[model samples]
Target: MSELTPLDKAEAAAKEAATDTVAVQLALAAVELAKAATAQQPAHSPACSHQHKPGRSTGEWLAIGCAVCVGGVGIAFASIAIAIGGISVAILAVVLRSLWRDYQRDVQKGR
Candidate 1:
């Protein structure tokens, strides 16, 4: 049988340590994300909010813009005119799109 050299053993040990470090990091991240998701009481009202990661998805901006735009339209229609069911439809589309974008980003970022 062949014996391993000191450097070879050290390399193997380092590789094992790297694996363990990655696993631990992954676990910690999952815990933090779960905590973030479940911690907040969803703000007291619409005026409250939060920030995003440094890098946000394209769809995130689209969703945010659509939500604001269509939401305004809906209110305009509700309080003023009545022929713009399209505004309600836009709101729904934006909501669904934002949800889908968030889900995709979370999955990709492994959180």
Candidate 2:
């Protein structure tokens, strides 16, 4: 292997310094981001924090389960109602149109 010349050594040192400077700048940017993230959050006072209770009780969970079941049943019933109502409305429209045509024919015939 050939010995590195002074110029080569100087270039290598300068590259290393540049890499270190970039690393330090990235680290500083990360720290600023972390600081900004923390600053964005609202600081909760100890008293205010305690006022809001965390987690649900067994009764609350049971109530939620019942509500979900009822909601599912309601949605099923609503879907059925909408389907039947749409079919009924379509049939009614067809019947009404035919009746209207017949009435017009009778009127034209002076009946």
Candidate 3:
């Protein structure tokens, strides 16, 4: 390759500087756009006003209480059913064991 002349070197440097300047300008424009967007928006929006009412009404509280009571009763019934099932399984096991023992005893006596 031929050696670059001073004029060519200066032109190449100018082109590189132009590209860098454009990139910096674009970054600055983005920052300005963001600032403008934030300026247009209110810090405390009127749409988020919690001025109407706070906390539950009397009827709402009553409904919540009734729901809790119903849930408790359902849980109690489920516990009772589980207990009855456990007792039934235990009784069945005991009866089966007794029958097996009697059968074995009879077989031994016959032999």
Candidate 4:
């Protein structure tokens, strides 16, 4: 690689300084533009002046309550149905087991 002379080093430093100056000027211009844009806008817009209620209305609350009650009743009925189905399966298994035992006993007796 060729060694840089004093003149070449000075030129390189000047070029870097010019680039940094241009970047700073661009940043200041952007900041001024943002300030001017905000100055032209109203502090409180018309939409922001209106009153707002964050909570739900009475009718909405009543509807939600009714939905919860209906869901609870539906769950209770489903639980009852599942319990009845399980009991029915258990009774069937017991009856089949008793029949199988009687059949084995008869076979052993030569019936």
Candidate 5:
């Protein structure tokens, strides 16, 4: 998955807002709000649909972070060890889950 940093998010938000119609903008904003409320997250980043496009999931992100940290500490302590192999596959699982969940949620919401 492409890494989405604050800079990338801000740029995308600006670009999307520039072209959005009034109703589309409001709907997108509402979706963002709903997502934030569902996650019980603060408005760290602005709620933009572009940022919510088909992407990774929490599990995949957790796994990747764990693997990276493990690899770093392991290499530092021992000679070398790649315990977490198939990084791409694991990450793909997250992407698939995120897409399917979003689709299901949309269907339930009658969107």
Candidate 6:
């Protein structure tokens, strides 16, 4: 049997990591949904033991907030890029616009 190349190993590791991340995110969503459902119930409800509190420390909460902010920004940019076709096209448009402006300025300076 042939040994796996370094790139192959890295790709396999990345796939595994992505799977694990999805699983963890699903689990966290399930927990949050459960908590929200339970919170809506009466205080005397039999299932209100409060054992499912996935409370995070201040730093952890701050980290989550930062992650959410970054993710939101990324999604916004991705949506814009998709709406205008590929990101490469959008980037090229911006670069060309800048170059055009620079060329116009240089032409004016030469006159």
**How would you encode candidate 1's per-residue C-alpha lDDT over 1-111 as one tens digit per residue?**
489999999999998898779788899899999999878756555663787459878999999999999999989878755546668888999999999999999999999
Cα displacement (angstroms), candidate 6, residue 89, comes to 10
Q: TM-score of each candidate?
A: 0.25, 0.46, 0.51, 0.59, 0.24, 0.30
lDDT of 3 by residue, 4-105 (tens): 999999999998898779787898899999999999997887876566768898999999999999999999999999999999999999999999999999
Which residue pairs come into collision in candidate 2? none
**lDDT per residue (tens digit) for residues 1-111 in model 5:** 589999999999988987686988888899999988879865476756465567789999999999999998878766433334456668889999999999999999999
Per-model CA lDDT versus the true structure: 0.86, 0.93, 0.94, 0.95, 0.83, 0.91
Q: Candidate 6 has what TM-score?
A: 0.30
lDDT by residue (1-111, candidate 6, tens digit) is 499999999999998898779788899999999999999978775755567877789999999999999999999999997887886888999999999999999999995
Best first by lDDT, ranked: 4, 3, 2, 6, 1, 5
Looking at model 4, residue 13 earns an lDDT score of 100
TM-score of 2: 0.46
- Model 1 clash pairs are none
Q: Point to the candidate with the largest lDDT.
A: 4
Give the residue spans of candidate 1 off by over 4 A: 1-82
Candidate 4 per-residue lDDT over residues 25-55, each given as its tens digit: 8988999999999999988778666788799
lDDT score for candidate 1 against the true structure: 0.86
Clashes of 5: 0
Best by TM-score: 4
Q: Candidate 1: deviation at residue 102, Å?
A: 0.6
Any idea what lDDT model 6 has? 0.91
How many Å off is the CA of 29 in candidate 3? 33
